[model samples]
Target: MNTYRLQQLLYEETDIEKIQKKKHNFIIDLPKYSFNYQNGLLTLNDTSFFKKNEYLFINKHNRYAACPKHCYQFIELNYMFSGKCTEKINGEKIDLKKGDILFLNAGSKHAISSLGKNDILITFLIKEKNIKVDLLSQTKGFLNISMENITPFFTDIFRDKQYHVFRNNEPLSFEQTLNNIIYEYYFPQIYSAEIIKCNLLKFFLLTARRSEKSCPDSQLEPHNSILLSQITEEINKNFKSLTLAVIAQKLNYNKNYISNFIKNQTGKTFTELINIRRVAEANKLIKHTNYSIAQISELVGFSSKTYFYSEYKKHFDHLPSHDRQYSAAEFLKV
Candidate 1:
């Protein structure tokens, strides 16, 4: 295409999408990348044909391409600011919408697809040194932490720290908070390595916390939340073979207290809450993939298909087959 024609094509395409339709090969060689921040538009740098530049990844593709399979040196994160991207990672497939945060950890192989225009993403290719110490320290704020001893590596990254998120809109005040970090706070000193390390760690913490707003332990009642968390952990690890009696005995509480506790905190009786989660997983498998109804039934902790289906319909108001066949958006209509 001629330059004029290409420029004209580009001009006609406003808010173009940044994604591909085909899967990209996962490549190793992930590195720390950075972009120049200017008016909500960050530039993507190119590091290798298979890999993008250090600090950030910026690409605009309508077709699917192989991503560099998971590498050892870096971790990848992408926040969809607009449009959507269907991703296939290792073996799991996920559809990312605006406001979603996707993480590709070290050694995690993945690929992606583009939907249409307005499908922009803000990405971070975090370096290993940044991931090991700095990111952990900042994100510890999200969890219950009591760090007494400061590691030398952590001390360096903490010299100046700030956090940022992509794809979600915030009030002017919050946006200004983001601005202060990007421009004012560490301000890219001669120790660019330290400055970059700090901001990236901050971003990791901010993004991780944003996704965990419904923290079980941070609920209205701390004690109740802690109990619920233990219950949840038990169910998660053994939801398939779960028994209310077993959980009640394990917590040294009467069955009635356990039942009432779950009801008061989660607004669902013990059995009902269990079914809620079991059925929720069933719904995801049903719509997002081609798992057979019977298969999904087992996967979600149902030992008996009949019982699973019965409980599923009771809570979801639809047969598992019908609900699973449709995406969450479509299921709501029914």
Candidate 2:
């Protein structure tokens, strides 16, 4: 099912008052239970929940107060399926809209605001041990680190302790990948665990790539960063007919200055940057859709098929047809 339908089903099946009542019962009924910040780790004490065979657990954020300011023992990947919510992290309030993802590491303390009726927030809780095991399994006997050292190793890999927020303007692919994971999680078919792992890895990699672009290093100046963002956004919107002169006139800057600024900031000229963006889109079309190379080239703003092929090869180091064939082979193998 599509994301919209899935969200509709989730909302229809979930009773907000019942969920709130459950939370209230847990707090009042159990004397030892406390969701407060100083109560240490918020261990979800559901015995039947998160089976040992399962690597991930899916939870729906349906309450108005959500949860108290607490932390978990596992990493949580929060995806905004629909509507909006506010996340208070590190003294900053981040307004999250549809298609946004908030990656919270283990032991990170944060709180969420009240969610709207249409707000469909899905949380994917991944066990820290599972991730550490997966990483070490690849190398086998290459490293002799004990279980006690695993958490520190993983922490070193992710040196930035702050939470990460990724804004996905176009969430079609993101939604599709998430749907696959959710499907696999609910319906346990043969090799479903393997499939979920693969899909989650793909989703994580895609988010990491997008995050790198969205949150760049601090070396970029404030003014240049703003200008660079505007330039890229304009190029993405009008790549079909985008040009340095057109961008300069639209942004009220000189053409030469714009060209030089782009080159200096991105390390690529205006034409080169546009070509890169077009070729990237063309690659996606060639792999995911059945569009011919010529048609895909034209769709991505290339006027001549010959020039498109040259630029495509220059960027990807392979012909479009070969790439398509390779992708098809990989899909069949899967």
Candidate 3:
């Protein structure tokens, strides 16, 4: 990710909370942000990697804000290999210079201006996911993360002005880490992305294990995992009748026990878990189809209009009619 994109992700995530940076060698603070379209390059040519053509934005931009510039899509990390700018990350503003690396989470937006003409930057484009399995071996299933995850993890700390070094040739540990990552991961062609992927799994496993965002309870036991998978299948097949009691009857577990088990093992109630899928499908229909809110509501199994509105608002913080217009930038703020 370049400085431009880093500014964008920051501009987006600033809505929820300020993400800080972690400490490294030479410099104490590194400021970064995310971008809009930084990851499109992975396609166009390489057929061997990331098969899915769709890129998911971790950020949702502020289309209505009067901003100097905007990010499109992509997780970007901006290493101020050397430069200066008055930057905005998800609307949060900062002054940045040399010896700083700014992280931008996916889909976040930001703006930047006022810079040295000689400013040079290094970028890392990545995707973040809780690591699905182990890198070296799958002996123990643990939650891991991608570099895409770190760009957001250390965002706030990098913004600390006390850590910036005005000097051009810097002796910062972050620089070294970046150098090591680039040289070690990108240079050697033998299993390059795989090695980086593996190391990324390790790095996240070491630090993110304790993160509040990590869903520990969702890690299913072998038997229960299979059962839950089956339950998920049934829910999709029969969302209209996929109640806790009905699901338990078919699976041979008591209704109350099944409800408690689902929450304990998945950290989501039966209704919440099922609604996640339903809402996802509804969102797609709202964005891609010409169906009215009422039509879409009925299609998604909401028999009552008021209940559908309430549920939709609870999930997206916007009405169904409101989000049906993402294609309309001017309509977003309405």
Candidate 4:
């Protein structure tokens, strides 16, 4: 367990007595806020309780006598690593046990009973923009559904103005993923942001796959599965010469519809998706073959060498020359 690391990052001490002693001081100066119940729901009005960060914030839930009903403008994920706690979401009571995770979307207010001294909850507060920019960018080939379809599902889980309890039935994988995230956060190295983003995506994908069984009806019905499949196949096979108009004509669909379909289904514009696949192919050639950068660029569908370099740097954070040199050094060592 990396409890010590977590303690170092989040709290001043792990001892219950010390934590209890300092708890009052922490909340004493908090801004005044109130819970407004309307339409049979409680809404927390003050948004100043949480400090904003560009990426994410990880902390332990302070041990208080009782938590007032509240919600935030950002997403919150609660994980119970030890002991247990009871929370009231909407009107239903949820008993969260060890290894249980509760995902609270934005604007969903709830209150908790007093937490036990042994109860440990790790809270993750993330901005929605961070999720879209960092996590969603790398999820190109993983799921069959588009971002448009999945966006509402996440909003429903986290921010939909409804009462929902999204928990993980199999939490072993989730536990491991969380550990990795904590480790990366506390002891960041080169490319740490990218590593953390990848792990966060993994966590979400696992949760989505697990929840699919229980909420099968929630899955977005594919609007044009056959067309999407054919289009993707075409892109994979002939991305070197592919264009939106070309695909539209070939599939007997309008160019605008084809563009929108790709964006809706893959969460990427048509050009972005093509470049992602092209850069992936370019990476392989740079690593394995003796081809020059310009040759590899042309082979991977990039017409201009400068454009290829820009895209490659955007994706890998390094140039082809750097990767080729590193590969050469490794080969010599072998």
Per-residue accuracy of model 2 over 177-248 as CA lDDT, tens digit each: 887887766656898777776676566556554544444444688888888899989998988889889999
The lDDT of each candidate is: 0.52, 0.69, 0.51, 0.70
How close is every model to the real structure, measured as TM-score?
A: 0.40, 0.51, 0.42, 0.51
Q: Total clashes, candidate 3?
A: 43
TM-score of candidate 4 on Cα atoms, chains taken together = 0.51
lDDT by residue (tens digit), candidate 3, 1-334: 2445434433442321222112111111112322222322111111222335321111211222223434433445555655555566533466666556555545444564533334444455543332332232432345453343543254432332211122223332355345434554434566755555555545434324323233333455688778878887888898754688889999999999889987877657899877766676788888878888788888887788898788776665457877766645545666
Error of 1 at 319 (Å): 29
Clashes of each: 32, 0, 43, 2
Q: What is the lDDT of residue 244 in candidate 1?
A: 88
lDDT of 1: 0.52
lDDT, candidate 4, residue 317? 49
What digit string (tens of lDDT, one per residue) describes model 1 on residues 1-334?
1334423442233221222332233222324463233332223333432232234333323323334222323455565645677776534467777666565554344455634445655454555453455445644756453222222222322221111123344421122222323332223446544554455545545544543453333555777767888998988777667888999999899998888888777656777667767877787788887778999898888889999878876654457766654565685687
The lDDT ranking, best first, is: 4, 2, 1, 3
